[model samples]
Target: MKHLLTLSISIFFITLFPSYSQDQSDNDFKEEVKRIEQLTIKSIKLRQQINPEAEQEALNDEIKTLDATLLKKVTLFLNEYGWKSKKEIGELANMGLFLAIQHSSTEEMESFKDIIERAYEADKIEENSYALYIDRLKVRNDLPQIFGTQYYFDEKSASLRFNEIEDFKNVNKRRKKVGLAKIEKYAKQNNIALD
Candidate 1:
């Protein structure tokens, strides 16, 4: 009877302590973010390997499943912690969160606009990723893209082209302000044609 009582007490303590200390939970979050970043890389590579043209429905379905899994995990984390800065969570974990949000639905991405802006202002996110995210959201809302980071498929030429932007005359100035190269140089490097 004493042994049974001692075993019960031990089990109670096991459940009560050390299973999720603050440090342990933080480490778990960091590791999960790292795993998520790696998974995003694999998802992108899988698409490239399976079908760059995106004609394969099977490949599309696989990508969607992977994206959904990532989105769900990221959303849960975001709900629990809001937005974490790079200093708070480290660069690798930040990258993982960035990629997960980028791969998420447009609405889901928009929902985090304030957090993105905060992260950007705090220099917690990369300039390139920040520009891309902002450009996408702006274009979605019928506003002119400021950074020209978003691209679209030109059906007429069957080529990828930068989406239309506001004030093309000074697009480079805006991009340069954000530490991006001039649009022409960027276009040349990416093999995109300028209209």
Candidate 2:
């Protein structure tokens, strides 16, 4: 009788534990997502404050520190859960991934490119974000950007300018297809004046 009772309890726990762990994992994943979102926003705002002047050196240092911490967490999360585990989590992961791109070495960016492509093919991330990643990678390689997602403030020209585009004439068509705003509007919104 005792043996029977023990066996039943064992079976009950065996069945319950997997579900319990899964629920825990889900919660943990969401918490990480929230962290990533907050960190990414903070990093972007800090980056905007950075300039050539030494006045913002402290802010730039903070941005670097945040980027390093964010990259470590993101690398661990990607190693554990990979790129296809959850839709919402994948979207949040993109925020971390973009920040990682800003600070990664060349080889690291290459590896990230593979992960981003895989995520895009799996439909885990949206097209717009996917394009941004690819375009950033292209810019790093000194290749023309396909999606026009990367831009810089040209202080000399007093305009916001996109990275080198593969084809200037059809860039807007490609941008629109990926749900990106028209280039002129994008430039204006980003405080870049068009010539």
How many clashes (backbone atoms < 3 Å, residues ≥3 apart in a chain or on different chains) does model 2 have? Answer: 1
- Candidate 2 residues lying further than 4 Å off, grouped into runs, are 48-55, 84-87, 90-94, 153-160, 193-195
- Quality of model 1 by C-alpha lDDT: 0.79
lDDT of 1 by residue, 1-195 (tens): 999999999999888777668668888777766766677677668667663335688777888888888778777877777667777867666776787788777798988888888878888788888988888888877788999887766768977688889999999988988889999998888777688
Clashes of each: 0, 1
Report lDDT (CA) for all predictions: 0.79, 0.76
Alpha carbon lDDT of residue 27, candidate 2? Answer: 95
- lDDT of residue 96 for candidate 1: 64
Worst lDDT 10-window in candidate 1:
46-55
Question: What TM-score, over all chains together, does every model reach?
Answer: 0.79, 0.79
Q: Model 1: which residue pairs collide?
A: none
What is the C-alpha lDDT profile of model 2 across 12-57, one tens digit per residue? 9999999999999999977877777788778777777766424666
